[model samples]
Target: MSEAFGSVLWLIVAIGILVTFHEFGHFWVARRCGVKVLRFSVGFGKPLWSRKDRHGTEFAIAAIPLGGYVKMLDEAEYEVPAAQLGQAFNRKPIWQRIAIVAAGPIANLILCVALLWVMFLIGKPDYSATLGPTQGLAAQAGLRDGDRLERIDGRSTETAMDALQVLMLAAIDHRDVAIQASDANGHEVQRKLALSRLPADFDQQNLEKAIGLVWHFQVAPATVGTVTPDSASAGLLQSGDQITAIDGQAVRYWNDIAPLVKQWGERGGEAMVEVDRQGERLALLMQPRQQLNPDTKQQAWVLGITPAPRKAPEHDALRRYGPLEAIPAAFRQTGRMASDSLAMMRRMLTGEASAKSISGAITIAQVANATAQQGPATFIFFLALLSLSLAILNLLPIPVLDGGHLLYYLIELVKGSPLSERSMVAGQYIGLALLAGLMGLAFYNDILRLVT
Candidate 1:
């Protein structure tokens, strides 16, 4: 299947499942609250398939895959018959109404937590910082080499990998990251370091292209693992030879060699590579090959040498947690993920992150396809995360969204009456406009990424 088609299929499935579950939450809650639900849909527009349930609620699958909604028998729109008055949505107690409105987001959060727990139980491979050289590049502002990072920008980190994630998120748009480091002696120091500014072509919505900085601890040794046939590195570098330097500059590790090679390509020049074969030093002149990464649409250089995997400390094979422990761990992990996502959103809003990050249906489809290819576990995890995001977004106080409706209901509760019809109509129009504008921007970004 074509990548685009695969992406769309997965996206449709992912969105369909999440939306159906979300609408189900509202439907279930409303029934419990004695409200008459008119329709429970899995998507928008004209219904392709539908059935009236035993309770007289029309359950449907619509033509559009965008989203779904629940229609309730609201008294504001029509007079409620005496017998059916008790089943009208507006007739329900405020608390009951609130519960119905809140169910959808809660359902999403529940999915996130459950998926995370399963992921933890299955266990994901984690790289340790201990595999790196005991000494390397410092933060340059105040952090010293050999100092282990404890936190980044005030976010507590359990592993070195988490710290790197925090740093990358803060680095978007050249933001300064506050890092806390500790030495063997247990002394801790905090310092703020500014990230290198993004290139002009960088897009914030496309995360893979926005932050390209390599983590300090992730550098591999400058030893070739495999050499492709008829490639640049095949005839020049041997598998066992240690790369000592590039272009006369000393290369202590795999990380050191990569930047030099990339720079050579960017500068459109040749580089001299020095290697240590046994005890004799050998030099080779190389010209980096520049090519566009079709996936990212960005220029990258290749020398055709794949680095050996970093040796990890032998740990007991993946450990599974008990049910009780898994629950809390899942909640904590999901909360952290949500917070990190929110931080990225804030950066995008402030223009600290590139606008390219505002992806449309195309990008989402691509992500879905890629995730699907990673196997069931990975795809389930992706669905959980996306469901959580969708739930959270729907709760936002913007009109035309679930959150917006909740916001209006809250106002009604506070004022002891619904907003004037004219006011509600105006808010609806405004919400529609905002939604349209955002979709336009996302589509435009998608097009730019496709063309450029």
Candidate 2:
């Protein structure tokens, strides 16, 4: 219950920020275009809180918090007195109207970039672009464990996330992706990853497993950090015990000890663990516990101990940029995100991708909560990602959306007249229906995911 409540609260805070910026875009541009803004609302339905500005505009916080709008004086929606006719939205030039309508999504895009800029300055925790044990086709392609990924198809990859993004796109396109990697001895090697064998309907959820891209490189010691109370290792293992061997087998890292523990649990055997406690070597006999994996719903071995801290290499540390240097980096990152989002949408629409890729409020709330727990940097990145998504979603050429409004304005510009009222209303109905269906599908996916 507490977790659910925290998710809900974080979701509200995140949505409030995005909605405020979206509406502010319209409000700012409308005022600049000399349009009389009547109301600036963060959400729909009756206003929960409202205050009339000096210019007679009502600033409000409404009951609903999912979305918001900026209401302007338009002759089509309401009567404008003769004295205020010049400030009416309907009376503005087509270009000004287009600008006013475009500003909301544009603001979202700008916010995404701005957030990324700040994020770059603050830096992000990242694992090295190194590979663990490779299996399947990747291994056959000569990609080996401990090979540090340098570049994918000419794009420099500093982290696993960067490599995954490029690899996912390559898989979706069914193309051979060129990769440059450095072996453990710092020897550079080249390889090509074939993606033609992937199913046409591959989605984000299982992409990593499908592509065999695992980031479990051995970079940390196998030292016990904590022991869960009342568990199998409760009294047998203590924190700060560096495991040197298990069952007479040398344990070089946590990876080495993990499989041994699992092997012991599978046969219900005891493990003879040799640990270095301070300057003394201690021998302990411990039995592994059988626990269910929450994610995969499979039974697995558990040691009830957390790994000690491991410091990454300086070169593999988080990337930080100065203010001036971060500008172009943020621009490139945002542009790439926009392109990837558009490509994914295109694939989904073309039946090449699964609709399960679409996430609703529940999934988003859970993600928000998870990222919030990670730290401020991760939460900021999450906001940027969601903001960019909002920008792209609103820019789609559908009615009732900013993109839809722009589409109508474009038609008006091209045809030299506004669309007929009946046609406009019909388009609006179609757009609303499409949006409703999309939302319903997203909600269904979210519920389905929650259950299974």
Most accurate candidate by TM-score: 2
lDDT for residue 68 in candidate 2, whole number 0-100 = 88
Displacement of the residue 294 alpha carbon in candidate 2, Å? 17
Q: Write the per-residue lDDT of candidate 2 for residues 1-452, one digit (tens) a residue.
A: 47799899889999999999999999999999999999999989999999997899999999988888898998999788999999999899999999999998899999999998998999877678887767766886798878888999999898888888888777878888889999989999999888877776565587767777666553567888889898888998888899998778878677777788877777777868899999799989888887887988988888888887775534454867999998999999899889888988998898766788799999999999988887777899899999999999999999999899899999999999999999989999999999999999999999999999
Cα error of candidate 1 at position 373, Å: 1.7
Residue-wise C-alpha lDDT for candidate 1, range 233-317, written one tens digit per residue:
7798887888888777888777677678787777887768888887789999878786677888987787878786677434322
> What are the RMSD figures for all models against the true structure?
7.1, 5.0
Off by over 4 Å in 1: 46-48, 76-81, 126-150, 153-161, 168-212, 216-320, 346-353
Top lDDT prediction, candidate number:
2
